[model samples]
Target chain A: MEQKKLITYTAGHASVRKQLLLFWTFFIIGSFTIGGGYAMILMMKRYLVEQYHWLKDEEFYDMLAISQVTPGPIAVNMATFVGYTQGGVLGSVLATLGVSIPAVAVIIVIAVFFPGFKDNVWIQRFFAGVIVGVVAQIATIVLDMGKRQKWTTISVIVCAGSLGVLFFVQQVSPIWLILGGGLVGLAVEALKPKSAGGASS
Target chain B: MSFLALFGVFFKIGIFTFGGGQAMIPLLQKDLVVNLAWVSMKEFLDFVAISEITPGPVAINMATFVGYKLRGLTGALVTSLGVILPSFIIILIVATVAHTFRTNLWVSAFLDGLQPVVLALLTYAVYSIAMGGIPAWWGYVAALGILLLILKYGKRLNLFLVLLAAGGLGLLMFR
Candidate 1:
């Protein structure tokens, strides 16, 4: 009976062990990551795409795009998607927990013991410096994505136009910008010839 | 605040926040720090800084930190759950349907459209953070150095190590 059950469950795709490995992988990545979700994307690319070959480059970029458009943290959204792809609902839960546990553990310790930690002068200076680094990291992602997209005319126009509105308009929600971009994409696709429209430039 | 109130507030934060973790700051400040007086503005700023430096989503870290401040481990559990619950449910639903519709032209086009906008949003993030003003010359130097280093050797070097090095340099120069 046990052998039969095992065979039934193991017909194809991820097994329990693979799910556990996925959990641990995210746990370690979540623990060490600094900066923010964008930073985590870099780490994910290194491990998931380059090291393990779990996801191809295009797949990773697609995931990144989906996570961005979704609500909540990009990292959490990504964890959910990746986990679901690998091992369904249970995998999603475990992966989310794995990524979150380290943060909760570390923060709880700091809150309990070093309540006044931020008041330290040296820590403040260090954060100031780190902020600069964070900015640089984000800039790198922007440039990297630009290169990957090959900076088509429409893409460049959309990028610059969005930036201009955000910079000049003040208080315009990014959601509108996102929606407008979608509309523009659809409109462009509708207008273009059948063959050209199908390809994402 | 009651645990239910805590959960409710965080759940609202989770669903509404878009463009990722940093974008949630204003909403958090408005609701928790400014209006509710749960934390002071200075404390909120400190939390933001701490959230960024730590190893997690800024929103999640903020929820956990604030919850711990308000009510210890239980509060942390509740608030974090509150924040995560919405996203978990939403993503689960989307994931279930998304795989089925992966080849749908409309869906693909929507995602494609979102790409450039997401890129723009990321660029804006860089701009806003830099606008915080570089107080010292070292800050600029550090920022440029990090940019160059990452551009050159990012694939080989661990980001955490670079961050640590930046912290050390900050201590030496800024402190």
Candidate 2:
């Protein structure tokens, strides 16, 4: 029965051991991550793509994109998405719990014991530096993700134009850019001939 | 505040917050500080500061911090659960739907379009962080150095250790 169950769920890529690994992976990410949700992206890429090879680059990027559009913290959204991909509902629960426990536990400790620690200059300095490191790591990941995309004329225009608006305007919500990108994609799909002319640049 | 109220407020916050940690700040200040008056302005500021410096998602940190301040450990638990619940439910539904229709042509095309835009957004994050976070020449050097280190070492290097080393570097230089 146990062997049969493993075969059944392996079709979805969930095993008890892999589920446990998912929990443990997210637990560690939840514990050490600083800065914010974006920082967690690099960590997730490292674990899921580079280390465990659980997700391919394309699929990982897909989840990253989805996590952005969905409401809430990107890290938690990602944990839920990746967990579900691996283990269905049960995987999602365990992974979400894994990522969330550290924040809850750590904050409770800080609140109950060391509310004044935020004022500590040394700790501030330390985190100031950690921010630098986080930025660097994220920069590297962005470069890598950029390199992987099959950039064409339209793709480059959309990417660059959106990046410019996001960086400079500061008022435009990202949702518009995302929706616009989808529209452009659909437009391209609609225009393409139903033959081998799909390679239009 | 009652635990249920605390949970409900956080759940509401969760449903509204898009983007992530930084985006949630204004909403939190508005809801908790301005509207509800659950925390004083100064306390709210302190919570933001603490959340910034601490490990984990800013949303989780802020929810936990505010919740604990209001009602202690149980409050923290409730609030964190509340904040997470919306995203959990939404992602589950979205993921399930996407999984079911992944092979459909339209969905794939939409995702393909999203890919470049997402890449652009990720690039913008790096640019913004560089502008806001890096103050000096050495900071750039440090960033570049770390990038090379990661590229060379790949998964063999531990990111946490890199962070610790950067912290030490900050102390040595900035202090």
Candidate 3:
């Protein structure tokens, strides 16, 4: 009989012969995740649009949009889902580390010696600029998501209505805001004609 | 709690926290502040403010600040490391094996669906921040202006200037 495909690992096919492989894999994954949160964001953007071609700019925006609203960093959450989907928990950890290693090394070094770097006003100024760049990047993601999802009158209504209820009115909580959106999504999808079900936009 | 216990607890938080630092705010508030009574509401608010104002992961800042407030500098370091340790350890584990895992199709679809929702939440967050942080009509106008400039020029625009400019404008108009 053929061997059964056991769910041996949450990520990667961690074989019995190569336990060392798993440890090294884990270490590298963890290190990278701690390091490269931002790089992962950019990389994910590229992967969706260019490599897999699974996500157009809008779908990429959708990925980014949901990633932002949920828990953890965008990199960790999205990467985890991707990794876990691939390899399980092990895969999740790998993607997490791949994204994080650069940041951990840099941040630890910075944290350890930030006192020394503290006096440099120019560095602070540069960081301030980095902040603006980060904001713009995040904003771009939002706009892209809107465009990608092809925010129809209804989606736009949901967006505005959610905004109003969330910020302006304050009757419902964010939990509800999300739930409401999901409901709206189900409704919208239901309303669409069955023939053109490829809501690709 | 023992140092190790504290380390373990924050480690769990670090590993589990999704949707960035802000997403964990309510749970952190409830567990540490409300239920456990590890911190007071005022102290929690102070930590929240500091985390938001400072750069880096908002959760890390809170962990450090709360640890320091509760014990001392050692507490700060321990808590900070604890918060990141799980992620650090796990990422290292995953990195070496990721290339092999990248091709799994089942893992891909779930992530696909989640992405759109996450983005929507963020857009909502931006709105929330604007409502709470902006504090004026001019503030809203400044946000729009900054957004426009960012779209046009991209990262070429300096964020420090943007923030300072926004703050300066806030001071000029509000004060």
Candidate 3: residue B67 Cα off by (Å)? 1.2
Q: How well is each residue in A1-201 modelled by candidate 1, as lDDT tens digits?
A: 111111011111478898898799889778877767876776777777887777776667777877776788888888887777777888888888888888788788878898777678887767676667777777787777878774668877988999999899978877788888878777765776665232432
Minimal lDDT window, size 10, model 2 chain B: B99-108
Docking class of 3: incorrect
How much DockQ does model 2 earn?
0.58
Ranking under DockQ, best-scoring first?
A: 2, 1, 3
Clashing pairs in 2: none
* lDDT head-to-head 1 vs 3, winner: 1
**Higher-ranked by TM-score: 1 or 2:** 2
TM-score of 1: 0.88
Clashes of 2: 0
What local lDDT score does residue A102 receive in model 3, on the 0 to 100 scale? 38
Q: What value of lDDT does candidate 3 attain over all alpha carbons? A: 0.51
TM-score of each: 0.88, 0.92, 0.57
| Consecutive 10-residue window with the lowest summed lDDT within model 3 chain A | A1-10
DockQ, per-model, please? 0.54, 0.58, 0.15
| Model 2, C-alpha of A186: deviation from truth (Å) | 1.6
* Model 1 Cα lDDT, one tens digit per residue, B1-175: 9999999999999999877877788999999987899999988888887887677888889999899889889999999888888878888887776663335556666666767888888888777776773458668777888899889986887776776777677777774
RMSD of each: 6.4, 5.2, 9.0
Q: Which order, best to worst by lDDT?
A: 2, 1, 3
